[model samples]
Target: MPTDAHPAAPRPAVDHDVLIVGGGHNGLTAAAYLARTGKRVLLLERDDHLGGAAVSAEAFEGVDARLSRYSYLVSLLPQRIVDDLGLDVRLVRRRFSSYTPDPRDPSRGLLVDGEADAASARDAFARVGAEGDAEAWQAFYAETARVAERLFPTLTEPLPTRAEARSLIADEHAWDAFVERPLGETIDARFADDLVRGVVATDGLIGTFTDLDDPSLDANRCFLYHVIGGGTGDWDVPVGGMGAVSGELARVAREAGAVLRTDAEVVAIDGDSGEVRWREGGVDRTARAHVVLAGVAPVVLDRLVAAAAGTASGATEPSAGAAASVAPRDEPAAGAHSDEVPLDAGARHRLARAGMPEGAQVKVNLLLTRLPRLADASVAPEQAFAGTFHINELETQLDAAYRRAAAGDLPDPLPCEIYCHTLSDRTILGTGLAESEAQTLTVFGLHVPDRLVDAHGNDELRERLRDAVLASLDSVLAEPIADVIAMDAAGRPCIEVKTTRDLEHALNMPGGNIFHGTLSWPWLEPGAEAATPADRWGVATAHPRVLMCGSGAVRGGAVSGIGGHNAAMAVLEEELP
Candidate 1:
């Protein structure tokens, strides 16, 4: 084991073998791997702390709940990385995967139990007219598992050709349904129940704002990442919140001799020269490295480089919900939507062609005094909220919401998922709060697309959206969700809302996209057949030495360290001459 540096120790060497921009989890993962290889790695973050969006914090003032504010839950993080890094983290699997209450029948609801509870699992499916779907569900997931087994391990390895990958799966029908065809078509064909179909379809719309049957098959890309995580697609709750995950990664990196620094914002990167400029302690600083792995999104990297080279007006991009003439980078070929992004037409053209990924999801964290009474009296509140409690997420409901959102309007009844993390782990709440039956609830609203928010006046829009979400919740619950409140010191309800605007302003996430950008096919598609081995890793940039170690990489997005892992692999390997 390498010696670890004290947190208060002076900065290490200015020059390093690798300089990772952005002290996010992915950056920390890269630093850890590179350090293990005996490379001199240095990580820089703009914020005062590590763990970019993956950190847990006391969101509401005067509240003891340490919430996973930005990105919650873990599905993509590989256990292999945990073992390899010797990370001290525990992931608890909920016994109940989800419980969707039937609006037509308040007394009964669909409850998806863990695999061990086969009886309950069957009962839930049967109640929803998905008795056949239980078997179909198993068959469908078995194929995903096969795909996962074949594909997940390759994420850390060099990128394989499309043909090579297909040969490994060796299932033509599976490929056609999952890869070639629209996810909506596959979901409708596989499951007879509209409710069941919507449950599966939600995976495709996690962060993507697109039509289910869009020609680009963007939803398929999103769905694949959601399910293929760790080859099992099981989303587990991280013990001690998400901060534990990133904190452990930072520790592993530091223990392995990686120098980590926060509040050291990287202002510019010259990929050709392997030079990085940053601001620290009220002074500009420069560092040299053989490789510069950017943990930031591609659009951010472009702006940083452009600003340093005097091509753009400055480093800062326009805030989210704003109308910008210059397109966000790595956006789909849709169009430009953000306000005045001071970039050249060539740069804007590039971003426009990629098409912008606008976020539609709204995250709300609440500290409830006690669990609300469920409409389905048969199921205990503890079991119903333990995992995901589906509200207004039926197939027809989801379709209606999606259509409205796609038309730049907020859905009437927002399709959202609610889960109480405290039911599984009571450690998130303060001792005083935890003892008194206080719990933390995380609600994620779908179909509240970025277009719905008024960029110039989002406060009103956000308030309206929040009200709509609460109203939607009230429709399913026996009592109004707002009635059971834990007041703050100021006597206000202990609840915090995060809109797409909040994401954009707080985390610099353009259009509030949680995945950083639109999800793309992890492997080489038809047009990308010409990509090189490095390009296949999705880490390669126009500049040879500047690799993307963040969610922008191929097989990227989610909380998984695949992007970081692939970036490190790219650096360690030799390119084909």
Candidate 2:
């Protein structure tokens, strides 16, 4: 909880001019934009805490405290790095409004789900031919805020190159009326119902595993209409929980000199011939830098980059002739971390390790003694989100939970979004951060893709997927969450048990599939990601001076870390661009 960086201990030559490796929040926004420009950065964090799910703890030593773990939420976190990292001073506020219980609208369980979703989207835009209040919901929020201001400068720029989106697409119409509409036929031609076209087509298909009747799930609702737009309506929070946005981006990555070690634990990274054969917590070191920026999960870097490109007998088969004879193509570098790391190779490298799973979106936090009170009596005790709930329910119950996740099964109708900023922040849960009758409630339940733990009812399918997601939150909290119980901690609860397969033994990513690969839209087409697929995964295919960011490198997954902010701006354009 006290983070300004540098305190996780047991260090030595775990090396780095820049090493990063998962301190989340896009590895602290690429170590506060690459240690402010000086560059000898180090940042590790296997966890001595630094806001991974944007943190906020004390699950039950008393009760009631919550954040987006109810799949914690953040909407386009930039606002000039939230006013150059002041983060609206320790931000926290959850009482959100978004619900749908549907047994055929039984009074939509009590409507006030966002003012009955903004008066059923202005009587679904005055019955589709548009025109109603706030001038037809301000011309449908001014054409969804011009498709969220030209898709928020290409979702934070970086991926340019269709000749840079065709020279930023000639005289813009906002890229021809919002990136080529379609999103469930532009919300069923401006809604009327189907619950406001299933909440504007469920944020254009959230972090892809696609299903709101699929067609690339209407680009996940044009990427949640660009976090629903900032004059305030989407979400953002920082303040005293979720470790104050990783303690102010680790105090802007230690006032930009950067070196935070904290509970160290490198164990061994060894990319060999080029350097970085680290070993921290137990000792045995060696450095010169093998470039890391990890945020982990690409099958723990193909078994720590094939045990740092194996020099002395380490092949329990990477095969393809032992990954080109333990990486030779001109010996790039990296090595260490052995005593054979396998557990399904860490689940087949969390399932093939390609990229983007929306940071595995499964967080649950609850510490309660009572105070969720929401069966929807038309909602207004300060518009009740006290502090948050973002679930976009019903589009055939979230496309039958992604058609039971394309067939692996784990969704008996479950798709959630919630928040509890201890009933409106007041310096962390209305002061007394809930330590006596209980407080903490955060649930972001989306299961049906990675089957959270049923390798065969393992520990009774992890408590039958946490009592079938608290019996689907007893179908909307008007009274029975048994007055908010006490203590529960799923966030990183030991690599999220059910299996971290020996803290991700190595390539066992199959059922773990934490996006070492596969957001599969033809692996993001157009030049199809630079390397791997035979180009031999990145960091210059072993180590050119090293560069590879987590969720297993390459535009991988959409936890929106952009593979450690585009591998720390391509290692600051190869050392000082």
lDDT of each: 0.79, 0.48
Models 1 onward score TM values of: 0.88, 0.31
For candidate 2, give the lDDT.
0.48
The count of backbone overlaps in candidate 1 is: 12
For this target, which candidate reaches the highest TM-score against the unseen true structure?
1
Every candidate's CA RMSD? 7.4, 22.3
- The residue-by-residue lDDT of candidate 1 on 411-445, one tens digit each, is 88888898788888888888898898888888899
Off by over 4 Å in 2: 1-20, 23-51, 54-107, 110-186, 189-194, 198-200, 205-262, 265-286, 289-293, 296-366, 370-416, 419-440, 443-524, 528-547, 558-577
In model 1, the worst 10-residue window by lDDT is 318-327
